[model samples]
Target: MSTTRTRARIATILAGLLVAALFAAPTAAPAAADPTTRHRPSPPHVVGTATVPVYSYADAIRESVWVETPADSDGDGVRDRVAVDVVRPREAAAAGVRVPVIMDASPYYLCCGRGNESELKTYDAAGVIAKAPLFYDNYFVPRGYAFVAVDLAGTARSTGCEDVGGPAEVGSATAVVDWLNGRARAYTADGRRVSAAWSTGRVGMIGKSWDGSVANGVAATGVPGLATIVPISAISSWYDYMRYNGVRRAADYPGYLHSYVNGRGEQACADVLARLRADSAEETGDRNGFWAQRDYRPLAGRVRASVFVAHGVNDLNVTTNQFARWWQELAEQGVPRKLWLYQAGHEDPFDVRRGAWVDTLHRWFDYWLQGLRNGVMDEPRVDLETALGTWTTQRDWPAPGTRDVRVALGAGDGVTGTLGGRGAQPGRERAYVDESLSEDALVAEPGTGGSGRLVFLSGALTAPLRISGSPSVRLRIRVDRPTTELTARLVDYGTAERIRYDSSEGVRTLATESCWGASTAADDACYRDTEEITAVTDHAVLTRGWLDAAHHRSLRFTTPLRPDVWYTVTVPLNAYDAVVPAGHVLGLVLGQSDPDFTEIDDRDATVRVDLGRSELVLPVTGRAGLPSVAVAPSVVTAPAERSSARTAPDNRQVP
Candidate 1:
């Protein structure tokens, strides 16, 4: 099985097991409290220059508390109390210096450790942290920042149930920020009310994967104190995590994650898990209110905080489309943001880009949290890593002036069809059956006859073409069945061998150690050795797009096409960075089904392609100076919240 397929098969199990990983002081005057409510000034009154260190980690203060929230998700709860473990420079207490807060509220704290060390939080009898995960505190505490590791709302020494990415999850994190900023209240485990002293109330949330997803969700709430967020490889929608388009993925994955995150054995969260499975709409594989509540993009316009988004282009664990769509939403909101795109798979930039990641992150924090005069904002907005392991910077992503270049598919010698920019000549329609097939099986040799798929090829290119963004497939076709799944892959066909991402998920780690930042005995900013992902092979599948013929008109509504009718649907391929060398050819594969996912009904359907009407649209990089046309939406859709789904003309993103 392919590495991606394997991960999808055991997504919840691996996500639960691999969840490890990864917070500050106040400097400026606190934001005003409501005149109706009483308020007290924050602790540590003095402040220092942003460029210099103001506190000492060796003599830092450690403490823990329970923050009270308004909701009670767990049945046995009396409202929710979030556990917060804090570490900050002793200088703040000794000399009355103030610092900003950096927090990482995570559910992984109790079940899986964080970082390469898999370090879980440890506390002394006084309920103070004896050990915290990663080096966020070790490196930043001395620099006058308070780092707090929160155990989310549940799972670790806190009250309430873990609702995955539901309302409770988002509310819990925002409540903590509220308390720090003097808007909400917290208490000691002994039932004593506590307040967040030693804080400027300026908070910046950062984390990877699940931990980061929480940050994104919290910021979407438009929380006041959250000044900025850095979410690495985070999921924008939980639905996208478990399902793709309108197809149900590997079975039992969502149930497994919910139960595992509860960490109180199967019986403890069986009801919650059961409820999740029931509400998922897995039977119809359609988008519902359950998934809509967890999606953050809709809340993007309300976000008041700056965002620094980062994700691996090769990440299959949390597919790239989720990030692409979310990032675009943030851009449309006109939020102050920066982006870091890497070439590696499901790994953190702290490990992938190391030196640069740290330096940039430090400046980012200093500028936002400390109100520093640093020129961080003046720098380029996009820091992207290409497939070759090299780096490039641009003013913005989608690289400013990209042009959508269309390549039409024409009739060819029976098996492989011709694909190019030249207008396609009218030709006989090609047909294919819907059958679950592996990527390799569908993309055999050029002349290889296949009953399950159709392969179309573009002549060897005389000049290299760099594609910076997603490519949409516009196809006009007729299918016999009411609903049939369509899978399209934009591939680079070359004689030279390439890395098989299916083998090791694109990258592997070595035994040697590569230190990223400063370190101590219990905590180190360094990590195990690593190399860029590679494996010389023949052809490389660049990107893929999927659609359900019946639901092509709308992801929420099932509108199957009439047997003899010809309809047009534009499918947006998953986002990726690919450069076709001068001598390599580009191939497009039209397959009925991908074995990687379980779409259930495997009914065979014959599809007839309208050669003259359909075309492959490529976002050719460095064509900004060229005349650019307005790009179409990923798919046609309707306002999805209502009972009957209709075409939502503005809804464009579809995969």
Candidate 2:
């Protein structure tokens, strides 16, 4: 090699070494606190810029208490009590150094379990907490932070009926916050009243799924002392959880879920279960007083604590709409917020990106709960996983330059249709039958005549087209029956390996283990390793929407359609973020009663579509990159003619 090349290479190596050495060096201790600012001085037990293990984890104090709530869910003329298990640093309490809290209130503490390993909380012989399930206690406790675990009311040892996400369930968390702030009552196991004198009255609630949901609910109540919350793949509305656009997705789920999570077999909760079933209104799948009471979006203005939200883009169980809708409201309310959107489905960030997740969380808590002068809030507002192991940061979600673009549908030779800059010619029509078919059948043979579905295809793109938000489909159609289930899917047709987010939440656990922080014999911070699951497919459904035709105009009531009368209806698809490759075609498949997602009975009605009045509206990013006529060439062709060089073992994404 030339001397110049060798010298340049040596300089690069030296620069990398210098960077590594700077990071390996220890940070200087924080300076004296300023009383006028929010920054607080580090206590004797805490000794780090952000936070580190300076205290003993094994010697942390372990205790349990019962917090009284104002809800009489069991209706025995008494208020309900929520069970709380707490672990904190012994040195902080001994030295009278009150510290903030990191709490996880969950119903799964005793039943169904938590996290990827499904670990449950354990107790010692003296009835004190022996082991808390996650790494929060073992790691944060040694960093001078207390980790409190609470079994939500109606589950485990708590005395109340499980009301799903109703007032009783929400009260379970708010009451605990109230007690920590010295505004409510709490008692020890021996019946002696106690106060949270050792606490600074600042709390940060963090959890996944149902546990995270409770955090959202409590934060919405505008409770004081709640410094911040980290809700991972959580639900914001119970109505959206069980239904979508007036279509029941999980029918009779409230009562079934209550029974599944309640481990105590208390007969008093029987009436609560009956009430849940009765108020669900499964017959009409309409939003009623029951769902209104459980929704947190309307109360977004009341939130006082900052929020750090994380959710999966492909989550089908709690679904992405839950977070999208809630995030929009939080933005409108001008709440201090941050977001992390992953490519996986219904999974926690701990399993997806453990090391980074832990480090980021530590800084977030230090800034919000400990009042540290950490620059975590000044960082980017959104962290999105674009693909497996590939991430990008943005100032906000839905990308910076996202806008809705209307792509019209054109007529195909009665079998297939075209999607382009303009709608089909006047009087053109396409028809289908209600057969409750799988997506595979609905999207198959798009170039030829098919049964049970109508297919529209955009020409293979010349440039990568990125969609950043929800898409909606508008159609003018007539059904032979009063009402029928309508399913619309936005699909990407090309051969590319993608994360199988729908399959097992996009992760598979390995036998190897990794440790996060200090550990003891009773409680360890080690967890099994996990890897993302991916597959090569010819076509993948980007997002889908389902609607009950009769309730399209109003989710609260139904309007029966007259036979052969054309009525325009809109189907709002789920939120999604993805980029389709240049050679890939964007397809729209319209059918009735999707067997994979909806469980409604099939009406077996014939339906006809007016092609000239149908269109697809997509939230496209970088409008200049995709011009008005750039979506696809103004050409009508079968999907088969577009490409035959690609193949996949599974053929397609199920939904």
Candidate 3:
């Protein structure tokens, strides 16, 4: 049977099996003969501790306290109490060892508020709360180290006016670190000395999300004694998070700000939410003003700590693009940095894959803070592509061995398969409607479904295709009218299913052509006549682009600009995992538009997909074997001749 027919048959059988399983379940279960016989097993032991050690600072070991501090250090206005959660090895005292200190500056207003205090108090009184200072304390603290969790100024017991992401926040963190270093030698009125002079003062900083961003922000100050930083899913730019792709994301801004400022309380959040809502993009668009004052990019080169950054590929709320941009910029500036990309949405680091993430962070911390020979630095960088169920390692970000293979689109007899076939050549092109899609039109849904929008399949591979590097698609075409939107997606086609890998989009404004090329302006008539009088330059037109397909794109090409004539747009495909399985195909999908992504539409358009003119270029590396495989054995036996001979003799005697 043909591959298509075989696939259809397998799909049918699978559907039938699913339907049968749904109905075949037992309606009722047999009751136990005796209720006492079915006694439930006792739950796992719930380890409880009064105080957990978070981290060990230079001379002293900082710890988490169920008790509160009596005095406020800074006299900036707010009276407060403070407590530090310390984590350290039990053998530290006996070994006279000094572990690295990792201080956590808790987010004000959200965590460690009055309600949080009440909850912590209740848990403490009940003797059930664990007070390790590390973010993932239950997982990291026990491995021989110390962690400190501090309530920022104006929250918990810390004093001073609350300054979110400002210098005051940094000061508060530094103050805690200072306090920790003197813990063993400091004296109270009663003459009790507190300090950890035995400790070696190696300190590090780590935070997740808000904490992560603050850590990055604080690291920019070039604070002394700060060793390393591991910022995960951090917000580097506030403007980028609130406003994406030049569009204001009104829905998320207010709610997010309110949640952070008010601690989810109506009274506290009302004023902040109102102020944020009233803010205008025009007033803050330029990063050189107040926004620039808040940016950490300026401090990128100054951050002395060894940094490890991790972000999810499918993080919708905090898109990975910003992190990618930061990584690229840092790399260009020669900053010591490492990055991990995992297949996950927002909160991916907190999921089952969190261990590996934490492990990576721990390795970095150990190497920089403790000076351990854990071989973490020796390991190749890891890229976890969950969709393909594979973990790839490379020496560099983009890896190596990427080949650009362009597959041209062609007009065929509606039979979907590989690109090579007898179809329209160079000069021949076909046109299709570019109106709003009808309800019945086959369109991709949001999120994962967007992968189905445009489809191209590669021929079955005799060997596993290893692809490691950036991929790009080049399309040469023209729309029936002026402005049109285009979306392209790359897919890994299995023997049975097509899985989306990556995608990008571009908007072409054809009519506004200057002497140089096409422009973004809507009015073409005004500029068409003065083409010669006014010098037309590349700046007046928009050209080849790279966008998240969900986002925007540029101008300039040595090739002439075409109006009704065919024009080519080249889009970069984000780096992805290679090693496509043998007998499976790779697919490239191109469409006029994708509704899931907001595209800039400027014309009442009729568009055509010029197959002969359009091509999907793939960067194919050398082949690799399947990562793993399993097989079963068969059995055989001889016949029993004696039994047959006895039966024949008996029959003859009866006859």
Candidate 4:
């Protein structure tokens, strides 16, 4: 036997034996004297903390249905119908046993696909689903769970206009939960009405990226029958996806993404697409009704389902701020939640920690969906990656002893400044011309005055410095132009090997495959293994923030700056966690028009900063001032930085 097949067989046997040894209870009673017992099918097997595989995966029933929704985004005068595919154990119907659901709703099923292999859904000759993408169906169907795949409205086989993350898109997915609970109607491919007779109506939604975002929106609605949600690298707000603060990072993003996901029925959706472009208002980049409809944070108080969130600290596509704000809101509402923080970028936990991830997820589903008395909730609430391949368990995020440390930016050579100093020179000021340049060119020299960025350096740390939350920057400044994009970066200067997040999302697929459950010819349960990618670098950008000067006061309103007049603006950087080495130097860079993250504009603008009034507030462990020191004036050299793409972080083509 080949090594791959042998490993696959071993893994399957181990997972089965794990639960069987723990409980070892008969699932069904022996056939009785009653004649009716002979015709009844066996029930699902149950163990101590999970359901063991007792049904045949190949014989599971596979079919498709169209669910009626209230949204008529396409303006066809008829209500929109969402496409839903289902795979469940045959025993669910024959033995009169109703099973729970595991659902993944996404627009990527047709255009971009799902998982590391990018597998698309395939159909059989009967026009029914043959091969469903990913291993969800193959693994969970035999364990007494129904797996559901939904083609979001306006994408794939569903009908309607893709409104990005607005009401239309959210309505399409939530309608499925309503259908399972007997609150909505559904029909077969032949237009015959159908009902979820074999379902328990307990749903758990899980996915990555946009698929995960849909789960967030649906959970915010507090729909009945939604047991829990597992959102990996998901976005909490649509405004944060297209821009940061008031700076527009991508122009006409809604229209561009809509075109990417919906390649068919263009004419029918022309009006909807046009409205998406106008409502986004790329020119102003201010928050309005369109954005409010898509924001999920305000509705956190209404969420009834437990949440399990997983995010990559270095993920620049959806970014860390999304999960940060979502986690905070869930906590404030006193909701049950769990979190997993990794060191990669834009990837799933199944790809990073395959074995542990599967085990934990299995227990979580058993507890929430099956009502098992498992100890999954008795463990720690947070799992954070401290370094490459190393993890630690914590009671909560932001480490318990973290405090905000205020560091002064002192004028040092009229160009570069000193951080963590005793006091600042109030009368001293630094000036820089706003121009388009790579981050490497802007942060090149620490002691020189020839660059277009104002740099500040702290002395070499004698002890390790660990930051665990979002960092904020307060700048008192005046600009030569009425409006310009303002940017700030927190950097680490040292020579070390770190996860290569910018390269293939820090993972490489291998030839060897690992199987999770039973399989068949059309849909299998095995997938290619993956390994983390690392690189040796001199420096790394810890976090960055951007803002439009005109909208500094509020994300909803804009007031152009008065040339030569000082304005105090606060820029909040992305949330992150890192431990700087004892000998590494912490640096801060302030500039305009970051070519790597923001749109380039107003090249002739110039910015001036009052060194005394500006400060950086960081959430650090131990004494706030213990990890910072003033750098010697003679040490002028700094390390070069790396840049990432300024477009969407997916593999699909964009306009």
Best by lDDT: 4
Report the C-alpha lDDT of model 1 over 1-655, residue by residue, as the tens digit: 9999887778655433322100111122212222211233333322332444445555678888888888887655588888998888887766666678999988888678876456788777777787788778877887778898888766788777777788888898899999888888887768788888778778999998888889999989887778889988888998877766776655655666666567455565566677788887877777888889889989997777788989877776777877888889988888778999887666678767677888898888887786654677889999987655678888987877777888777666666677764434554577888766766666656455667787777766677778877888898888898878788988777755444456444556778876543455555556676566676656777888777777787777688778879889777788887567876777788886665543444667888888778888888876421111122111111211211111112211111
* Candidate 2 structure lDDT: 0.81
- Tell how far residue 212 is off in model 1, in angstroms: 1.6
Off by over 4 Å in 4: 1-43, 624-655
- Candidate 3: regions farther than 4 A off: 1-98, 104-135, 138-144, 150-201, 207-213, 233-244, 247-261, 264-299, 311-317, 338-362, 383-392, 403-455, 469-487, 495-575, 590-620, 623-655
> How many collisions per candidate?
27, 0, 37, 0
- Which candidate would rank higher by TM-score, 1 or 3? 1
Off by over 4 Å in 1: 1-54, 125-127, 265-268, 423-427, 495-505, 514-521, 597-601, 623-655
Q: Model 4: clashing residue pairs?
A: none
Model 4, CA-based lDDT? 0.82
Tens digits of per-residue lDDT for model 2, 1-655? 9999999899778755543432222221111222322255557654554777778888888899999999988888989888899999998888898878999999888886788888898898988888889889988988888888988889998998888888999998899998887989999989999888888777899999888889999988888778789999898998878777787775567877888887558487888888999998888988889989989999998887788999888887778888888899888887778999888898999999988899999988887777676788789999999877999899997898899988888774456677775668756888898877776666655665667788887777879998988889998898999999899998887778988976788998999999987788887889999999999877777888988999978887899888958999999998988888887778889988765666744788888888888889899888523323322333322243221111212211111
Task: Report the lDDT tens digits of candidate 4 across residue range 1-655.
Answer: 9999999898778755543322221121111212333344435555655788988889999999999999998999989899999999996679888888999999988788899999898889987888888888988888889999999999999999889898989999999999987888999999999999788777889999899999999999888778789999998998988878888776677888998898457798999999999988678899988998999999998777778999999988888999999999998887778999999999999999988888888878877777665788789999998889999998887787988888888776555677787637775688887756577767666666654688888877788899999998998888887778888888877778899988888888999999998888988899999989998876788888888888888999898998868999998889999898888878888877776666665445788888788899998988645333444343434545533333322222221
Q: Return the top candidate by TM-score.
A: 4
**Tens digit of lDDT per residue, candidate 3, span 1-655?**
9999999898778755543432222111111111332343311211121112332322333233421233332442333334444545545655665555676666542253311111231123422224332244333444445666655544453434333444555555655555554532233323355564544455677765666766777667655456667777666666555443333333334345434533224443354345444542332222223345446776776665666777655444455544655665566656566767655434334332434655666666665655454566667755555332346666656455555655565543333323433334776554544332321122222112221133334455568766654456766656554444554455444433212212111111234422211111221111111111121111110001122211222211022233556556666544444455676545454544323322323243454556667666555665342221111011111211111111111100000
**Candidate rank order under lDDT:** 4, 2, 1, 3
Query: CA lDDT of each candidate?
Result: 0.72, 0.81, 0.44, 0.82
The CA root-mean-square deviation of candidate 2, after full C-alpha superposition on the true structure, stands at 11.7
Candidate that beats the other on lDDT, 1 or 4, i.e. the better one = 4
* lDDT assessment of candidate 1: 0.72
Q: How big is the positional error of residue 235 in model 1, measured in Å on the Cα after superposition?
A: 1.1
